[model samples]
Target: MAKVNGKYETIFIVNPNLGEEAIAAIVEKFKTLIEKNGTVESVDDWGKRRMAYEINDLREGYYTLIQFESAPTFPAELDRIYKITDGVMRSIIISRD
Candidate 1:
């Protein structure tokens, strides 16, 4: 498939400490927000797994994969929001092209 020049794919890792419902809610919120302004190719949850290293003292986390279409400039804003989110251990957004 042809991806727009400004489009991107974002994959963020959420903390595993959140209950199942909370995890679901967070993922759904992301799906809703991303789909509202752009296109979402997929949203995948890899479940809990051990991390390579500790993050905020966390050794494991709920691994989630998200593939969405977005503008070039949108990632920074998204990153900023994710950085402040409590249950988000770490998040990174990369261009899918």
Candidate 2:
């Protein structure tokens, strides 16, 4: 089968209630997941930041940005993972290519 790899950027916010250790673990989990399914180019941890609006009655979150190259079909799986994770507050995946 042919690989249809494309560049993608994902920005996700995790609940601020989580401890630093837990937050780091979550970031690592996603990094590994992306690297395993694709190629991780960069990971930028923006740390905690104020949200523009409230979500789940929370006003702040830990932000992370990951740039990667992956097969076209892989994003849906990533999105699904993000949705099911307990601490994730919001996320977005966009094609950079």
Candidate 3:
């Protein structure tokens, strides 16, 4: 677990069409990236869900959360990848205490 000080909480939506293997691959990819010099405190599969809005015409998505300790710049890199990933419908990251 990360310390009681501030960290990051991120929720990235995966394309619902992606199966377990693909999803695992994607998760591993991000896990490696985010925790390169730090540690992942928690990960949660929020499961498949319906998006409140449309994204690439995808209405339903697989939601997951990753809490980690890292530099502030890390979230920017995460956002960049999320923007271009074909398997991600949407993503959001926030600071957590």
**Candidate 2: segments with Cα more than 4 A from true spot:** none
> Highest lDDT: which candidate?
2
Model 2 gets an lDDT of 0.96
Q: Is candidate 2 or candidate 3 better by lDDT?
A: 2
How do the residues 1-96 of candidate 3 rate in per-residue lDDT, one tens digit apiece? 644434998899888788988987887788888878467999998888898998888888888999998776677878898888879777898988
1 or 2, greater by TM-score: 2
**Per-residue lDDT of candidate 1, residues 1-97 (tens digit):** 7654356667777877888999888878777877776778888888888999999898988877878777666677778878887788778888867
Clashing pairs in 3: none
Q: What is the lDDT of residue 93 in candidate 3?
A: 88
Clashes of 2: 0
Candidate with better TM-score, 2 vs 3: 2
lDDT of 2 at 66: 100
Ranking by lDDT: 2, 3, 1
- Deviation (Å) of 5 in candidate 3: 8.5
The candidate maximizing TM-score is 2
